[model samples]
Target: MRLPFTHSKQEPANTRTARKLCWDSRDEYFRCLDRIGVLNPNDPTQKSKINANCANEDAKFDENCATSWISYFKEKRVVDFKRARALEEVNRNVENNQQAKGSQE
Candidate 1:
C-alpha cells in the first residue's frame, strides 16, 4: 500500500521525519513482495484463489514483513519523541542561562 505524498508546508518536523521513516520501512515490504512475485488475489490476472487452508509462502513472508515495518515505526516514534523532548529541554536551559546572565549584569 503506497501512501500518498504530501506537499503541505504546514506539516511539523517530527511528522515529516516519522513519515519518511514509515515510508522507508514500507518500501522494504514492497520490495520483498515484488521479489516473491506475490500478486494481490483480487487482481484479475490471478486465477488461482488463495484459500485460508492453502498456505502461500510468499504471502506469509509478506505478512511477516508487514509486522516488521509496524515494529520499526513503533520504535521510531519513541526515539523521535525523546529526541524532540531533549532538544526542547536544551533550548529552554540555554534561554534560562542567558536570562540569568543578563540579570546579573
Candidate 2:
C-alpha cells in the first residue's frame, strides 16, 4: 500500500518531520495571505492596496513562518515523547515495587 505523502526511499517514515513540514508550509501560506491582505476577511479598504509589495512581503514572511513552525513542532514532539517515556518508566517502577511489596506480605 502507498503511504500518505511518501516521496521517496531517501525519506524515512517520520510523523514528526511530516507534521513539522506541513505546519511550516501552512504557516508560510497564511503569513503570505495575511500580508497580502487582499481578502483581509476583516478590513475591506486595505484589500486593494495589497499589491506587489504586500505579495512579496507576505511570501517571504510565510516561508520563514512555515519553517519556524516545523522546527517548533519537532522540538515539541521530542519533549512530549521524552515525557511520555519517563512516565512509562515511572509507572513500571511503581508496578514492580507494588509487586515486590505484595510478595513480602
Candidate 3:
C-alpha cells in the first residue's frame, strides 16, 4: 500500500518518528487484512463500505492506525495533563501560603 505523505526534514522529529512507526505497522495491518480476507477487494464498493462503517475499536486497518495514533498522543496527553495539574497545585499552594501570611501579618 502506498502512503500519501512523504517524510520531510521540515517536519518535527516526533512527527517524522510517528509517521515511520505507523508506516512500519502497515505491513502487519495488511497481513491482518489478508487473513481476514479483506486485503484483496472483490469490489471497490466493498472496501469503501467497510471503511465507511469501520470503527477504531475493531482493530482492523483503520482501527490499528487510529489506535496507534491515539495511544501515542494519549501518552503525551497524559504527561501534559500531569504537568499541568502539578503546576496548578503548586500555584494553589503558593496562593494559600500567601493568604496565610497576609492574614498573619
RMSD, one per candidate, in order: 17.7, 14.6, 15.0
**Segments of candidate 2 deviating more than 4 angstroms:** 1-65
Q: What is the lDDT of residue 65 in candidate 2?
A: 43
lDDT of 2 at 63: 45
Q: How many residue pairs clash in each candidate?
A: 0, 2, 0
lDDT of 1 by residue, 4-100 (tens): 4464322223456665654664555434434546434234453343333223543433343344455554455457667999999999999999999
- Candidate with maximal lDDT: 2
What's the lDDT for all of these models? 0.51, 0.54, 0.51
Candidate 1 regions exceeding 4 Å error are 1-65
TM-score of each: 0.40, 0.39, 0.37
- Clashing residue pairs in candidate 1 are none
Q: Model 3: how far is 44 from its true place, Å?
A: 35
Candidate 2 lDDT tens digits, 26-102: 45544565555433322456555554445555444344344445346435655765799999999999999999999
- What lDDT would candidate 2 get against the real structure? 0.54
Model 3 Cα lDDT, one tens digit per residue, 1-105 = 434455331221346665666555554544444455553332455566445443332243333354445455435544755789999999999999999999999
